[model samples]
Target: MEYISFARLIEAVYLPQIIYTVIALTLSCMSSHRSSTSTELLTAATVQVSSDNQSPNSGNPENTYSDIISSSVHNITVIGVYMVIFAIAGNLMCSYFSGDACTIISTYLEIGGGVPVLYSMDISTKIKTALILSLTAFGGLSALFQSRDMIRISGLSFIKYTTGKIVCAFLCFIFYMMCL
Candidate 1:
């Protein structure tokens, strides 16, 4: 009886897992190309904002900042870098205007990611899996390329991060197989 119930539970979740796995693999492959473009975008933002010594007269501040944030492209290679950089820029700008950086960043992530929002539960788990893979792959490739500081993830070293990614990817495939 116990074994039969466990089998049924697995069967119920299997198809979604397989779909998630395929999506995760595809996202990982896309992330490789995004890493390079992301690096470039990060570099541009750092140059424009990080230097306190730059003269305010060099260009209109709005243009300088807007250039960093306005990207509508959705290709993983382009949109990945664009959204990350734009989010940082948005947070940085909010801090500059509101005088509270940490609060702004936290709020932005919460609102943008629906992190604490219950509605996020309905979001596709496959997307969550894809995001994890993309982020892990991007961070690993960035470190290998010597831009470790550009993408800072807390609490996990690169090896651990990559290991977790692999485990998740495997589970995603297993989930699919179980469903099939």
Candidate 2:
């Protein structure tokens, strides 16, 4: 049995994820047609609150804060519910397939299946690694659904979403080839 070190796993897996997250965020910000104006309101409120202890809402600022916090919590809960349902349904659909087909289905649902599938394959480790990396780059159907739900309020088109996924997958394959 091959024993992989923790550092190797971090270097190969965690570091790539961090890099991908940074790149994804940079791309998202660059691609957005309109930037959020909400930050201006928050900055103004912070300046005002800091400038005066005698502010009119000094006694009720906590109430306002609590309202914001409560709303954020509610939004998180709703999103969590949606993700759970999506994962459950995807897993159920994947359960019907076996061997490589099962691996592909599970990977389509989430990237978590990639490692197991890679291990199960009789192919060379290098190819297995590439497959896992490619699967991660695809971001799975579950991720696509989540993205759709999140962007529902932003008027993002389905065509754009699919195009982005295709571009990402292509980049991932290139990255895998470079690594190999």
The best candidate in terms of TM-score: 2
What are the lDDT figures for the candidates, one per model? 0.43, 0.60
Off by over 4 Å in 2: 1-63, 112-123
- Count of clashes, each model: 4, 0
Query: What is every candidate's alpha-carbon RMSD to the true fold?
Result: 16.9, 7.4
Q: Estimated TM-score per prediction?
A: 0.24, 0.53
lDDT of 1 at 62: 79
Give the runs in model 1 whose Cα sits over 4 Å from its true position. 1-63, 66-150, 153-156
Scored by lDDT, the top model is 2
Point out the worst 10-residue segment of candidate 1 by lDDT. 110-119
- What is candidate 1's TM-score against the reference? 0.24
> How far does residue 91 in candidate 1 sit from its true spot (Å)?
40
